[model samples]
Target: MKTPFIVLEGLEGAGKSTVLQVITQWLEQRGIDYLTVREPGGTPLAESLRELIKKDWDERVSPEAELLVMYAARVQLVNEVIKPALAQGRWVIGDRHDLSSQAYQGGGRQLSKNMLAQLSDMTLQGFKPDLTLYLDIEPAVGLARASARGALDRIEREALGFFERTRARYQELAAADPSIKTIDAEQTPEQVKAHVLAVLEAQWPS
Candidate 1:
């Protein structure tokens, strides 16, 4: 049987990194062989794309260009890293995935879901994660947490409305998809961690 592909997603400072540590620890305790990778990365070419996409450029980068570049990196990583690992029976834990594009580009950039779906079909075919943990937070709260970490990246510097749109899309999508479990990230870290672990444990018990 194909191994599972699990993904964590959220707005900036929704504490995805902290959630990742929880997952890795859980996997290690169970002696599960797993590989962790971040979107727009996970391969040499993809990593470069990650930098290009995240860095500030003097020229205005079109939404179409941004979307395409993101897909390119995802394609490379999916083909090279994720697919291979799953084929060999290792669980793949992703920091972000296609859902991110669906929210960020399709929502924040105001691109149509149809357009995003077409791109997803062309690049990813039908492959998708078995489970997704979506940490939901208010944009302002999340952004404040993000900014506290220091310098804001290109996407991080977007106006508040952009993230508001993004968060709305995320909630809409999560509500429609049963495979996605939403955690209230505005709560204390312990509460958020408990919610995440509860979902994970219930989903895949030892």
Candidate 2:
């Protein structure tokens, strides 16, 4: 079987972590070697950048700076972790990837998509995940879940409008791209698990 690069994308508290665990178990059962990676924190430098990005800052951070920092962390992780793991013929399951930037920065922050495109081209040269499972959830529900978890991070603390825009862009992108699959996350965990397993079986029915 070919090594696959699979990415899980969604707003916070959209049940991505649960889906990731399920996928990990499936890979173990199939005896396929796999690596699990989280965006902006898979490498040393990238982890530092993740802290910087998520930390609450006393001073205002410009949207451009926020976008660049995310890309910077992404470039580090891609080069140091994801690419190397894939080169070794290992399947990779990513918690998040470039799509998050598109949704969070481009849509939530209202940054220019052209700028995002330019940055993506410059950093990744059109490289993309083989399969993306996007867990779609209402901002209100997702936010309430996130809030219940404790202190929200910088991005998670954004206004409801920010996440609303992010979810809209996620839906828009999923509709436009066949490789990006959308999973309804508002359902019960059992239903969500069934949908995720169905998607995986359909995509990789070995």
Find the 10 residues in a row with the least total lDDT in model 1. Answer: 1-10
Tens digits of lDDT, candidate 1, 75-163:
99999999999999999999999999999999999999999999999999988999999999999999999999999999999999999
Q: What is the TM-score of each candidate against the true structure?
A: 0.98, 0.98
Candidate 2 runs further than 4 Å off: none
Ten-residue region with minimum lDDT total, candidate 2: 1-10
Write out the backbone clash pairs for model 1.
none
RMSD in angstroms, all models?
0.8, 0.8
Largest lDDT belongs to which candidate?
1
